[model samples]
Target: MGELARALTRHGIRVRVVAAHSPGLPVYGKIGDIEIVRPRYWWPERLEMLRREVGGLPVVWRKYPLARVQILSFFLMHAFVTARYAQSCDVVHAQWTLSAGAACLGRWVHRCPVLVTVYGSDILQVPRHPIGAWLTWLVLSCCDRITAVSHALQKRVVQLGVSPERVLVVPIGVDVTKFLPADDVHRENLILFVGSLIERKGVRYLLEAMPQILSVFPEYRLVIAGDGPEIISLKQRAVELGISRQVDFVGFQSQDNVRVLMQRARVVVLPSLEEGMGAVLVEAMACGTPVVASRVDGIQDVVTEEVGVLVSPANPMELAEGIRTVLFDPIRWREYSYNARLRAVKYYNWDIIVPRFIQIYQSLVG
Candidate 1:
C-alpha cells in the first residue's frame, strides 16, 4: 500500500492514507511527500468489548466472527472518515478489496472515481468464505479500475467476474539505493528466510530440508526471520530433526534489519505454495542475494535464471539440492549475485515501477 501511494504521489497526485485499526491514537504523518492518516480506536473500551465477545468461543470460531465484526466496523468507520476526506480528491484509490468496499461507499457519497488493487489473499484466500466471496465480487464489480500484482491475479479477478479490461497488473517496486550489494567480505555463511512462519509459506519444507542442508554444509546456518502461530511448531520440528542447533529463529525484524540480513546471507529461500508477488524476493535480489524459491506464479515472475533458481514446491530434497547448488559453487553464486542486483535495478526498482502506476492513475483521472 505504501509503495502504491508513494508511486501515485510521484505523479503529482496528493495522497492521504486513512488506515483503520492501526495501533495508538490517530497520526497524520508523511513518508516522503505522501500523507498518512492512521486512526487508532479508543482501546480500553473497545478492548473490554472484544474481550467479552472473544473470551468464550473456540479458537477457529473466534477468528471468523472477530474478523467479520472487525471488517464491518472498519467499513463503517472508514466510510464516515473517507467521505469527509475524499471530497478533495478526484479518485479514491483503495489499497485492498475490502478497502475498495469502503472506497465504493465513499465514492457514491462523494461522487469520486474508485480504483482498487487486489493482492493475492484478498481474492484467492479471503473469498473462500461465502460472505467474503459475495463482498469481494461486489467490490470488484463496483470499482472503476482494478489492479493486480501479477497476470495470474489478473486472471483470478476476471474469473471473479471483473471485466478483463478493468484488471491491470502493476507489481510492487523495490528501492535500489537502500538495498544494494554488500561488500564481498561482508557476505557470509548465512542462509536467510524472511516472511511469516505459516504453512502456506512452506517454512515446514525448509525445516524438513535442514537435515540434508546441514549434513553437507555443517558450518552454514539457517536464519528464519518473521513470526506467526507456526513458530513453536517449526522450532519443535527443528528439534525433532536434530538440526535445531543449525537454525536461528529471529522473529520479526525492521526493514533495515531485513536488508542487512539479506545483504549478509549467501542465499535467500521462499518456498511458498502461493504468492501474489513475493516482495521480499525483489528486496533480496536488490541486495545481491540469490534466491531459491518454488516455481509458483509470483515466485516464477521474480526468480529468473539470471537472478536465482526456481524449483518444485513441497519437495525438500529438490529445495535442499537447489540451495546446495548455489552455496557450494562460488562461480555460479557470484554470477547469480551480480545478476540479481542487475535484475532488481532493471525491472524491480521504484523508478521504473512507480511511473507505470502513475500513468494508470493519470489515465483514469483524465
Candidate 2:
C-alpha cells in the first residue's frame, strides 16, 4: 500500500490512506504527498490491540476473546472515515474483502464506485465459516468491481458467484530498483525464508527439512525472518530436529533489510501450504535470487522451472531434495539467478504493474 500510494502520487494522483489505528503511529500524518488517517476503533486507547498481528482481527479474536467488542467499533469507524473521505475522492479502492464491506458504505454517501482487491484469506478462508460466507457475499454484492492478487484467487471469487467480468488479477507491485542484486554479487551459503511464522505458511515443514538439508550442505544455514503465533513452537521444533544451530530465527525484517538478505542468499524459500501469490518470491527473484517454494496455488504462477524449483507442499524429503537440487547444481543455480531477474522485471515490477492499475481506475472512472 505504501508503494501503491507513492507510485500513484508520482503519476499525479492524490492518495489518502485511511487505516485502522496502531499504537505508535500518528492518527493523522503525511508520508510525502500522501495523506494518512488512522481512525481509532476502540476506547481507552491502550486496549486497542485489534490490528497488531499479521493475521489481523481473526488472530486477535482467537487469542483474546475480549477483543471481540472492538470488531463492531472497527467496522463503524472504518465505514464512517471511509465515507468521510469518499465524499472527496474520485474512486474508492479497498484492499481486503472485510474492509471493502466498510468502503462500500461510502457509496451511500458519495455514490462513487468501490473496488476491492482480495489478497488470499478473505475469499479462501473466510467463506468456510457460515456467517463469514454470508458476510463475504454481502461485501461482494456491494462492490462495483473486484481485483484479485492471483488467478487462483480470481477463480475462488468466481466460485462465490461474482461475475468473471467484475474481477481482474492485479498483483501488488515491487520496486525492482531498490530490491536489486548486491553490487558485489556474491551469493552466500544462506537459505532465506520470509513471512509470518504461521501454521498455514508451512514454516515447520521447512524446519523439519532442515536436518536433511544440513547433512549434505553443512556450511549452509536457514534464516527464518518474520514472527507470528507459531514462532515459539517452531523454535522448539528446530531444537527437537537437532538443526537448531543450522537455523536462525531473525524475527521480522524491514523491507530494506530483507532486500539486502535476498541479494546475499543463495536461495529464498517459501514453503507455504497456501498463497494468493508469493510476494516474497517475486521480491527475491528481483534480487536475482532463485526460489524454492511449494507447488501450490499462485506460487506455481510465480516460480518456473527456468527460475527455480518447486516441490510438494508438506513433504520434508521433497523440500530437502528441492533445496539440494538448486544448491549443488552450479549450472542450474546460475541459470535460475539470471532468469529470475528477467522474469521479475517483465512481470512483477511496479513499472509494469502500476500502469495496469491506472488503466483499471480510468476504465471505472470513465
TM-score of each: 0.92, 0.97
**174-241, model 2: which lDDT tens digit per residue?**
88888887753477899999999888899999989988888898999999989889999999999999
lDDT of each: 0.81, 0.88
* Top lDDT prediction, candidate number: 2
Off by over 4 Å in 2: 183-185
Q: Write the per-residue lDDT of candidate 1 for residues 78-180, one digit (tens) a residue.
A: 7777787888877787888867888788776777888887767777777788887888899889888988888878888888777899888887788898898
In model 1, state the lDDT of residue 294.
Answer: 93
RMSD, one per candidate, in order? 3.5, 1.2
Best by TM-score: 2
